[model samples]
Target: MTKESMMLPARTYSVSIDRDWRALYEEIWQPEYFTKWASGLAESDLRADGDGWLADGPEGPIRIRFTPHNDYGVMDHFVDADTGSEVHIPLRVVQNGDGAEVMLTLYRQPGMSDEKFAADAKWINGDLKALKALFTPQRGRNG
Candidate 1:
């Protein structure tokens, strides 16, 4: 593929969180917070590696680079698979009335089987739900 090429067969998944977008983004930036809700994205612990992160993916060890912290609530990340292929994962937290909407875009990579893509989509949906649950309030015993 040429440089700056865009992948096709993309899907965008989103979840609604009952919290301020900025605050949610800040909480997500905290160390270990991501792993709590993104277990499907990284199967093993993620360790700091200079400006990027290293994780033991299901296939093998992989490197990830995240977008720098900013005021715009962007948390885009790129993953480099052990097979020498790189995939861009677009993520964002945006305001939705009094709540926040988190969106993640998944691109169907070249040679990716349909079954694998469907599984990834389901995993992404579950991960997003887990993220929303973090900001959801729990019911007390009285309830």
Candidate 2:
């Protein structure tokens, strides 16, 4: 069956980062950088193969296909979870004044309990904070 056929209810969460949109996009919009901030792949090694990316997921190895970078700030991806199901992640980065706002949409799939969904949301929030920290200025750094 097609991955889209298994989609579930989605919830969106966003975080603002004080950095240039283009710079942020260039830095983290690729598959190679996903492991840096995404909690799901935190323990996995990600690599770009052909049209998609290969990585070690929580259950096992998986493949992820991401939308190409565009002017509209879409950074969505389809991840083949170990359950043999494909999960769609919708992400975006839009210009917010002199900075950028990153948004991530999480889908609550079938069989997922309320607590699991809440935990997932918290995890995403932490990941977004980590992303913002990447560009944050250090106390000793000269701007």
Candidate 3:
């Protein structure tokens, strides 16, 4: 048996949504939404290769394809270009009475670094915050 040289660290982050979290996620989590929310976005849908999806930001391009789960959730299978490994990012929705909660979890390979973990955390935190701000109605704001 051979030891793995490089491995990605596991990371997870979540936030509450103003609307139905599952529905909003299913509707909004896409390349278009990333371009709208994420900085320095570059994305495309390559149809020649079975509708492969690509999105790039400050953390480099994350090539992935999405699949909807039966339990009102979704999964992003990240294609590791370097090591040919796959990383799974799972998202779920939790009902919170009038609104909902969005949970995002990132599962990385073993031996991921502190720097990478921190970066991923910061990005997800900020992204969720921004998303909530955009969807949530502010006090005294017009309908």
Q: Once model 3 is optimally superposed onto the true structure by TM-score, how far is the C-alpha of residue 102 displaced, in angstroms?
A: 0.8
TM-score each candidate. 0.88, 0.85, 0.67
Q: Highest TM-score, which number?
A: 1
Residue by residue across 1-143, what tens digits does model 2's lDDT show?
Answer: 89987668889999999988878888888777878788778888888779888888776789999999787778999988666778888999999999899999999978999999999999899999988887887786564
Q: For model 1, how does the per-residue alpha-carbon lDDT over 2-22 read when each residue is reduced to its tens digit?
A: 755754789999999989889
* Clash count (model 1, backbone only): 0
Q: Which candidate would rank higher by TM-score, 1 or 2?
A: 1
Q: Relative to the unseen true structure, what is the C-alpha lDDT of residue 18 in candidate 2, on a scale of 0 to 100?
A: 90
Task: Note the residue pairs that clash in candidate 3.
Answer: none
Task: Pick the winner on lDDT between candidates 1 and 2.
Answer: 2
lDDT of 3 by residue, 28-86 (tens): 65545655544434243222135546554345555555563445555443554434665
- Model 2: residues with Cα > 4 Å off, grouped in runs: 1-7, 140-143
Candidate 2 lDDT (Cα, 0 to 1): 0.87
RMSD to the hidden true structure, all candidates = 2.6, 3.9, 4.6
Best model number under lDDT = 2
Candidate 2 worst ten-residue window by lDDT: 134-143
